[model samples]
Target: MRHRPATYLEAEEVRAILARPNPATVEGGRDYALLLFLYNTGARVSEAADLCWSDLQLTAPRLVCLHGKGRKDRLLPLWRDTVAALHRLRMNAQPDRQPHVFLNRRGEALSRDGIAYILRRHVQGATQALPTLDRKRITPHVLRHSCAVALLQSGTDITVIRDYLGHASIATTGRYLSTNLQTKRDALETFWQHAGIRPVRAKAWKPTPNLLAFLDSL
Candidate 1:
């Protein structure tokens, strides 16, 4: 498809994207806060768009419920800032609203493309600060991938990541951690060492000076 996301953004790039939207006004605040909600919750674009008022549980231990693929529901914890952003977004957009979390300028529920367009608008702004963004196709899915991979890099268990993404199989979620070849190599090397593989020294095979002289004479 024309909108396929090729890669993920680093944490810093995410910050740049968050800083793009001017939250001085309600509309700007909604856009800015929506990005935070996506990054912090690691929710899919559809999940974020499909969110209802009741899905939010913003309390001491903040959480949001996302209804994902296969009509399954997954609950994820939200950071304090994420909760704050959602509060702002809800206050501004849902003043008299009910079901959906995000709405268009016309007060209709946001569609997948609408969310993608919003992300793209901010991504272009982020490019100036994070030049690496220039090479990437940053979609809402990429943000989700970034969240999963960032957790992996920070040493979170793969199974936890699978559950976080509501993935049916760990193999499906493992694609995020597999992006780092070095991590895999390190793990394999550790396994080999623990398996009692002996390390060989190439220096031990070097010919002696006398042997080299005899070979030269021969």
Candidate 2:
């Protein structure tokens, strides 16, 4: 059996991927917006594709994630741009549009692989440019990692990232933070600044009887 490849995208690679022009056809802008949404929210491919029109608060600034892994549910705030993108997609959709957030050319929901293919089409070139990325293949999971890393770089707490990603363990979400060099450097320096060093001393002073008696009286 073929093993699933690891997914992680660096900050610069995500920027390059997002910089591409949206396709001129069906669900193009919405798809591009989905990529940005995942990069910002760290949502899984299925989670983003499974999102429903009703899942979003059309008149508000938030979205509900109902189809998370294990049927777990959560709410993720949407940026104005992300909300606008969803609006565009919703406007273009047919009157009896399906609930799925992402649709194929036939107006059917996109599978996980379909979403992966969409992302790869835009990200392959960007991935190839990176000297560290030898595979030249990019996927939705990479966008998820990019989101987590970006948040960590911005000083988001580990516990928060864990909650946002809906991880069962904080350790799972912690791996993303480990790749952020700047965060690690800042953490190290902060620790050094607050840690005062003292030499081991030979003094073993004991309280005098008079001092003890005075203390007892007080």
Candidate 3:
């Protein structure tokens, strides 16, 4: 069956969701960091859930090694904000032997379901500030789609996004090209420029004499 175009959040909507988590508390900090990480790296929910401290390089040239499908691993650069949020989460975390980057109230590694629940809760809370979010079904994978679209909008190469998302084929990444309205508008503008097609304004319409006579008969 054909799948629908992926649902994604605009950058501002993403910012609103990220703001929902109160970073002052441990769980709140983790939730924020988790959401930021998903947006930053376009990681699959499973990859994010399975992340470990050993998978990260939090220092200069911050990077993460995401273990993807079929044991394929890809390295992604971390955004400065992502690094900062993660740092705060680490500092606030209760001392524990858990190696996972994200943990629950019981200090166990967060499962994929746990991550989804966190995203859903935050999305609901964010809806008050961004009513548009209420119309979209936001999920962890939607964040992945949003990341890909954001990269495309910023002029990042499609192949780079393919590898960034750890897609086995470039074809999977190409789907993002069709989902962005701004990208389509840009393409159309470029096409018009190259084709020498000048936009013409439509003349205002008035009823024809025959049509006016017919209406008058009624």
Candidate 4:
């Protein structure tokens, strides 16, 4: 079978992973939380890794991405659970680095590759423990796909998902839409049902002189 991206992690799997004792420390756990946050949010690895403290605001429960693909900036809303994870992370974070949202042990910003490495390790650990998910490998980008798929699966609008993911084109976000087989079937059934009920009838009456006059006037 062809290897494809892991679109969604079943709710039970998600629970299992989250239920596991976080193996990383205060700083490291914060990084891990941020990684999960990014994965859950469908944020680009770079955008999440370079995020600053000021970029996140609890008021709107959102994060402002400064540098996105094509150097564009966009605002991303956080899910309630994602926000909770962030709060927990911030509480244990070191005081030396109040600037960066994700900091290394040295209190410096984490590199994009560093974040990817963290995700790789985390997935490896999570999969090793969960033998049931051995065939379903996860990665940073896969997490991104999972976020989009989760939204699409939950009956979210495709345009909204596109905007949330900061996608420049709707086509870029369509991949997530493809995984929603139930949504597609529902749409097709609705279309056929509506088509069956709506009868196409031709106009039987001839145009009156007044109608002709109106058309002439126009």
| Model 1 Cα lDDT, one tens digit per residue, 1-218 | 12322266666677788889888877778787788777665688888898888888878556776788877766666666767877877776554555787888888888999999999999998898888999888889887766654554444555555566666422325455344323333332332232211332211123334433322221
lDDT of 2 by residue, 1-218 (tens): 33333345555556567656364545578676777677656688878778777777756535544457766665555555566777777777763658777888888888898888877776665555554555555667766655554444444565555566666422324455344323433432332222201112222323344423322221
Model 4 lDDT tens row, 63-165: 4444677766655545445566677777765535457777766777887877777665655666766776567765566556655544544456665655566
Query: Largest lDDT belongs to which candidate?
Result: 3
lDDT of 2 at 141: 73
Ten contiguous residues with the weakest lDDT in model 2:
191-200
Measured by TM-score, the strongest candidate is 3
Sorted on TM-score, best first, the list reads 3, 1, 2, 4
Reference-based lDDT, residue 184, model 4: 35
Task: Judge candidate 2 against the unseen true structure and give its global Cα lDDT, from 0 to 1.
Answer: 0.58
Worst-scoring 10-residue span by lDDT in model 3? 191-200
Candidate 2 or 4, higher lDDT? 2
Q: Provide the overall lDDT of each model, using Cα atoms, as 2-decimal numbers.
A: 0.66, 0.58, 0.71, 0.55
Which model, 1 or 4, shows the larger TM-score?
1
